[model samples]
Target chain A: MKAVTYQGKKKVEVKEVGDAKLIKRDDMLVRVTSTAICGSDLHIYHGLIPGMYDDYVIGHEPMGIVEETGPDVTRVKKGDRVIIPFNVACGECFFCTNQMESQCDNANDAKDTGGYFGYSETYGGYMGGQAELLRVPFGNFVPFKVPEDAEVEDEKILFLSDILPTAYWGVDNAGVKPGDTVIILGCGPVGLLTQ
Target chain B: MDYRLEHAKRTNHVETYNFEKTHDIDQTLLEATKGGADVVIDCVGLDAKRTAMEKVETALMLQGGSLGAFNTAANVVRKFGTIQVIGVYGLKYNMFPFGHLFERNVQVKMGQAPVIHYMPELFRQIQTGKIDPTDIITHRLHISDAPRAYEIFDNKDESCIKVVLKP
Candidate 1:
């Protein structure tokens, strides 16, 4: 499959890589239709994020059709349109049950932190979606089925994967009350969303 | 008004401070606030030039009888006022006039933004069209043009606000 691989600071290339497949019964295979680049991706591109292995796919926010799923993957099936959550968490983990899915103990246990799709070492180094397809682990926990009527605007739905949730988190953390004057420092995608 | 501040004024109530044109930061603050503003929010973060200017503005704002909100660093606000630090600073930063804050009984609040917690509410707002974040996307480019987009974004070009890449 063709995937965008991070080369080094300020360098990236679309290259052929091994096909993604379900390694676990809970895994699901997705054929990506649309993917969006995030500000965090720039951190990897700029080398601000360390421990990114060479030839790793570079994208997390993606929407696609479920091409296949494991027998245990009951949340979605073939031909189902879905949005892949950036974080790949095991719902039974201590953190997952607590709604701290990003910090799930089993997601990126090898990396010493919860794993995330397409993020570098600091995050669990799961492969990302800047590719033709992605192998989603624990697919039932992360893939959110898009409502039939919600497919009207792909961009808006694609954002459901990360930016929208992240922005809302910012507003909530800042304790933005009704009519409260809030000022965001950076007007980046997240900042704009928060505003 | 500082040109940048003047531009921000179109959408927000902003008072510009050009240090090159003014010497008395306190006086400028006095003028901006008739007596003083009830709350002053600093949107400018660690841009050294902006930070320096904001420090002076914040001090003046407090001296002018307003309770200043130093939204940059916790220590930048006047003694006895509140400082709400929202900007993310990459490096370790130092505080100014530590003794003054202690004496004035100033309050400080700062930390990372927990983005995941608010997802449900923010999602509903966006889905309902109450907020359109795409308005800030000033540039749209193909994934192949990511390098150029980075260059434009890092350089702070007036024309570029945000860039979205299509893959």
Candidate 2:
């Protein structure tokens, strides 16, 4: 499969890498239809993120038709349309149950934080979804099924994978009220959305 | 920057400021909010524009990326106000305003967004048309065009805000 691979500072290439397959019992393979380049991906592109080597697959926001699912994956099926959230969570961990999936215990071993798709080894060594195919682990929880009946364009909901929820969480976490004056610092995607 | 500021003003109907143009940004924000803003969200994280000293420090690994946005957040937030950081900040910084925050009873909340926890509600909002996120997408290219996509996005070419790739 062809994937966006990180070469070094300000360099990337779409190379033919090995196909992503179902490895874990809870894993699923997704035939990516849509993917996005995140602002944080720039950190990797600029060589600021450690534990990244050449040709590391580098995308996190992706959604598509599920090509296959492991036997244990009962939440989604082969033909289901789904969006893979950037966080790679087991869904059964203490953090996942407590609404802290980003800090899931089972995702990343390199750091104390949770696992992230396509991020450097600091988050987890999981391959990114920039490729034609993505191997998504923790399939029971990681993949959010796009409502089959919605009939909305992918652009409308693709940000659920990251920035939309991120902006919402920023506002929600800060307890911004109806009359409260909220000042967002940046005009980036997340900042714009937060405003 | 003008394009984004204009977009924010026109679409969201919110006041926007360019830090580079404003001589005293914190003072301006404080006056605009009539004391200080109740909430200051830091969407620009470590990679924000740095001062000459910060540029040198960051180059030497003596500090994290620029604390410019964080400093502005600190300065523009009212006493006992909240500052939420949605942007990514890694490593340690030299001048982390602990004393000021502690004295003012300010609250700081940060870290990665646990996206799964909020996905359902956001999805519902999108489905209901309460918000439309598609306007942020300025480019749509094939997955094979990723190299050029990265260049344009990194360089902020053609007013590129977001880029989506179709595989």
Candidate 3:
């Protein structure tokens, strides 16, 4: 499958890599139809993020058609359209049940932080989505089905995988009250998207 | 106004300021809200405007990133207010004002947004014209142009606010 791989510091190349397939009982294979370059991707591109292995497929925000699903993948089936959120989480974890999927206990490589696609080893080293296909582990928890008949462009909803949601998370976690004069500092994607 | 300030005005009642125009940004913010902004959110994080000393050090490759926005956030948020950070920070921060926050009783909230949790609601808003994310996008290119896209956006050239790669 074709993917974007890290060549070296501040270098990347889109080339052929190994095809992604279902690896676990809850895994699912997604044929990526649309993917976006996120601000965090710049962290990897600029060498700010450490411990990134070369040739790791490097994109976290994407949505696509399900090519195959393992026996345990019940939330979505083959042929369903889905958005693969950046955080790879096990739905049953304490953090997941509390809607803090980013801190899900099961997906971390180290002690506390949860798994993230194409991020460094600090977050679990899940392969990214900037490829022809992706292996979505804990697939049932992170893949949200999108309607086939929806009359919206993929660009409109692609950010849901990261920026847009992160924006909302900022507002929600801040406990922003009605009529509160909030000062959102940055004018970047996440900053701009935050409600 | 940049994309965010403009988009925000249409959806909510808000005022924006360009710190570049003012000598003291924290002071400007303090005076604008009649004391201080009730909630000062740090969206720039590490990319906050750096001072001459910090700029030279960063240019010399002595720093990973700066927490200038965090400092300003702590300064400008009203006493007993909330500070929300949506900006991405690479790692640990130095010279951060921990003492001032304690004295002012300001609460800080920062983290990754639960993307999946908010998707359905934001999707509906986008579909219904309550929010328009596309207003912020300035360029759309093919996936093959990822390198060029990164270069342009990173350099902040051509009025590039955001670039979308079709893959």
Candidate 4:
């Protein structure tokens, strides 16, 4: 399958790579229908992120059909339309249970930080979804089920994987209320979404 | 081009300006907001514009990426105001403004977004048409164009705000 791999500073390439395969019992393989280049991805593209070597797959925002699921997957199954959140979280962990899945204790073995897809090894060495297919873990939690209705387009919901939620979280984090004067520093994707 | 600032105004109906264009963003924001804004959100993170010294420090590994936005946040936020950071920052900084933030009793919150937690509500908002994330997408290219896509996005060429890649 062809996936976008990091070449070096300000460089990326579409290269044929190994097909994604389900390895863990709760893993799911998604045939990516749509994926996006995030502002954070540019950090890696600029060679700022450590642990990213040449050919490291690099993307996070993705949504598509669940082509296959591992034996133990239950929350979603084959053929389910889902948006994979960047965070690789186990739902039962303390942080996950407390609504802080981004800091899930079990996702990343390399560092204390939670696991994220396609990021450098600091987050997790998981391959990103900027390809034909992606291997998603913690199937019971990570794959967010999109509405089964056919009306929703992939474009409408893909940002839910990151920017939309990140924007909302930013507003909520600052306790901004209606009529309050809030100054947003960056007019990038996440910043614009926050507005 | 000021495409990004214009897009924010036209699409989101927010008053926006380019900080780089202003002589002093701190003074401009302070005067405009009557001393300071109630809240300041630093979404630019480590990728913000760098001064010459910052470039040297960052290149030497003595500091993380530019703290320009964060420092601006510290200066332009009202006393006891809140500063929320949504942008990604790495490692440590040479001169983090802990003393100023502490003196002002400012509150700060930052981290990875914990995206899964807000999925349900945001999805509902999309379903109901209260928000449209797709509005930001200015380019749609095939996966094979990954190199050009990254270049355009990083350079903000072609007024590119966002790019979606299909395989």
Q: Which residue pairs collide, candidate 4?
A: none
Please give the interface root mean square deviation for model 3, in Å. 2.1
Q: Write the per-residue lDDT of candidate 1 for residues B1-167, one digit (tens) a residue.
A: 14334434433344345545667554555455443332223333343243454456534442211122232322333334444444333333244445665685655444433233344555566678775555455666665665566667655565565555565
In the order shown, what is each candidate's alpha-carbon RMSD? 7.4, 0.9, 2.3, 0.9
Candidate 2 local lDDT, residue B143 = 94
Off by over 4 Å in 4: none
Candidate 1's TM-score reads: 0.71
* Tens digits of lDDT, candidate 3, A1-195: 888887777788888788998889999999988887787788788777777888877889888889999998888888988888998889888889988888888998664887888786778878888888999998778898887788777777777888877877788888888988878787667766764
lDDT of 4 by residue, B1-167 (tens): 38889989999998877887889879998999999989999999998889999999999888888999999999999999999999988699988999999999999999998999899888998899898888899999999998999989989999999999998
What tens-digit string does per-residue lDDT give for candidate 4 at A107-129?
A: 99999989999998888899998
How does each model score on lDDT? 0.62, 0.92, 0.80, 0.91
Clashing residue pairs in candidate 1 are A115-A124
Please state the i-RMS of candidate 2.
0.7
Task: State how far residue B83 of model 3 sits from its true place (Å).
Answer: 0.4
* Model 2 CA deviation exceeding 4 Å by range: none
Question: Per-residue error at B36 for model 1, in Å?
Answer: 12
Tens digits of per-residue lDDT, candidate 3, B1-167, equal 35446656664455667777679988888888788878877878667767887777665666647778888899889999999987888566557788899999999888876666677887788788777677667788776777787777776777776777666
Candidate 2 per-residue lDDT over residues B1-167, each given as its tens digit = 77888888877889999988999998999999999889999999997888899888988888888888998999889999999998887598988888988888889999899999798888999999999999989999999999999999988899998999998
lDDT score, residue A130, model 3?
83
